[model samples]
Target: MAVVTTAVRSGLLFPLFLLSIDASFQRKSGTKTQNIGSFWNGSTGRSERGTELSCCALINVQMRQVFPIHAQQTRPKKECRDRLVQYNDQLDAVLGELEHHPEILLRAVVADGQYAKDLFVETVTGHGFALISKLQRNANLNYVYDGPDQQRRGPKRKHDGKVTFADLSRFDVVNESAAERILTQVVWGVRWKRLLRVVVIQVLDHHGQVIKYAVLFSTDITMSASEVVALYRSRFEIEYVFRDGKQFLGLQDAQMRTQQALESHWNLTLLVMNLARLEALRANNGAQTLVFGVEDLKRRAYNALFAQVILVNLGLEARFEELIANPSGPLNFGLKAA
Candidate 1:
């Protein structure tokens, strides 16, 4: 039987997945479908050069989702006077609908900086459990630790202001797996960045050269040696969804002027992508290998569907002209998931 079982559970419809495993199960050489749950939050620019006001649900930590939110143009254009509200209100409703069903345990939430509100944080925490999130990061994070003597030191008199990426980078340790010295390097500064932290995990590979295991996170959890690595690695799957959605899913080709249309279309696309993933998984005899990478998805789905065809064609025309004059090689349009 597959060790990783994904299920939707309880009245919460909370997208819960189970991964309870025994040692005997691991010893056997069988396929294990680990329950993948992630709350992916982020925003996208409505237009290539327009405001990035789009954010929505992501599956398996995938960044491929659409918001059913709408807003009106209310600034700069005195002639086009209107009241603009973010689509977050609608996205919140969608999440609320999903939250009622408690099957989804590992909720992967995605939102922009503005969505990091106090109420949002409380709502998610009310469930008594949920993994790390992009919601408000340093609100009262200075509260004391509460693990056993073997873990935390209980409550303290005061908090250490707020832990910054810079402070964490200075700390390092020898990993248990390969006994390599792992270092956490800060990529973004708290004062300068909204997310407060963005670090990368690096270690010397078989060769002495430093290798980036993955980009680190912004959570305040007491990261164990393996936890840091796990968090970083988890981000890759989300990125895959983004790349595939944009390239094959035609996420960037949206032309809807009103926000509601934009949001509904976006949500539909993600739903379609998930269904396709399920279809592909079944077709492959239950092997979890992702055959549909970003490139494949673009050619098969986005290119076949979405309206960015004219724009993409025009962009390629300009590139082709440039290549003819100063050819280097095929330009790498997309690679990283984020």
Candidate 2:
């Protein structure tokens, strides 16, 4: 229940277009461990074979505020004494919270390949939200038949053939590299039980040979292929949040043992992130176009605290926020002596 139960912004509320959620792991290695479990630490690009707390954080599309709504310590299958819970169950809890609050107006959920499974897709869609994520490179997809059928058939043609890069046709070209080495395709994903829209982006060498490609899809087939690619691309916003939280905000700095302590520390870090944003926005007079950031807010806070100490020692009755907002202004250090 750490979810934000109140509106984040003021005036002319807009529909929340995208909500990006992903798990962040804290690497832990110690003698005494309680709820610690081995989890994937993406920052290291390798499996963290030690105890880690898998935290799920949700971010607004514009990177306005990030909320760590749910977190559970990952438990290794062999060491787990009780039933092991997956990200899907935690994500369901998050979606369920949003469902009760219609004012949030969440339209779609954006995540990485980790959440591209059928269970996650069905769970997200069940909450009336579209799932935007990438499919594995070797995904088993088949083209559904829409062509004229032959009378001689038993189960009928469920698939045209195995879909490969060479045989796929591009319905529309979404992007082209300046060097003419990359092409993005938006086409119907054939061969799957459910009709889906897929985006195939291929990078070719100078010889026009396929070097790399990405296949992104959306459960809400009505969305254009371009929209699918864009939404999936925005999923990285949460990744950036994790990076900032770790590097600047000390997201992975805690070393608590109990579940309550671990959860509290994780939630507190995310709460600080949101509070910094809220403070920054207020500092900018609620202007979304401003360039204020969390670091800047931290810097201002440091100055404000220093100025408050100085003002209190001098028996001054002036506002410390003015000094914080404009440290070099006349009111801060230029005030006339009594």
Candidate 3:
């Protein structure tokens, strides 16, 4: 939270922050490891038979830059888990960190369809944040009753009728393209028991027929439909953090069995990635557009370390600056071309 606050204060990051929440499974072994259970392997798109740790993360997305705020293990199931912490409970832990930094302008909390439950939505909205997420295609939704009420009614009518996706004429068409159509309406969610600004995306085929559709909703009814769609799309940026951590930062390489040791390793792995991103942004000096490649950063660091070790071993440390000053020297050996 301090790092995020500093970035916002220093003008490196915008005041608006969109919190993206998701979980990833880390493959682990050994009978002594705690909280190990069958978790969904996103890479393989299936539940792995082997034991794994369910790590949930909160990422702050601003344009192209992603800042990882918190990550911890959550129990995948309540039946066999010793310490049964639900996903919503782990999310509350992440939100607790944000509460300390009230100055940060948080716009909304975006998650996937898995978090579209009433409890999760209430948790996010309770934190004074607008919850934006995907809902089931056939979610139980009803149009808000806008007609005149009866003069002698016992109670006012709340819902008019069930919402039908095939008949979007009642809804407002916000966007249309060759690929899909975006329609929105302020309706009452039966299951959620609240008003929702729902966006229905009707995907089109080559012949312009409706092949399938998706449903996205936000608690903020005043938010525009296009903005909701765009924000939900940006939620995928958090997945990159998990990808880089596992591939380059050894996110699943921990050998520890205890919860504390594993948590420390997970935090350190993501923290290093966050530091690297901050360094990259600092090097760019707040440029509007800058290419950030983690692989290139790793390559440059390796080259610098290799050059420093060879210079010190050869008793040529005095000439290190001159050697590195040369553009074609060892320090620049394997860097990608700009």
Strongest candidate by lDDT: 3
TM-score, each model? 0.46, 0.79, 0.87
For model 3, the superposed segments whose C-alpha errors exceed 4 Å read: 50-61, 76-85, 303-338
Residues 4-121, model 3: lDDT tens digits: 6766777877767787777787888766677776777878999874344434444445555677776666654654443323667777777777787777777888889988987788
All candidates in order of TM-score, best leading = 3, 2, 1
- The alpha-carbon deviation from the true structure for residue 155 of candidate 3, after best TM-score superposition, in angstroms, is 1.6
Give the per-residue lDDT digits (tens) of candidate 2, residues 1-338: 22343424453113354766677777666757665656666768886655555555555555344555566665566776422246677778888877776557676888888777777777888888888888887776665556778799587666565556565663457566633332343234433346666677777677767777787788787887666766677666666566767778887777777767777777687777766655555555543564434555565556567777788998873866565456456332432231
RMSD of every prediction: 16.4, 5.7, 3.4
Clashing pairs in model 3, backbone N/Cα/C closer than 3 A = none
Q: Please, what is the whole-model Cα lDDT of each candidate in the order they appear?
A: 0.37, 0.63, 0.78
Could you tell which candidate, 2 or 3, scores higher by lDDT?
3
Worst lDDT window (10 residues) for model 1? 19-28
Candidate 1 deviates by what RMSD? Answer: 16.4
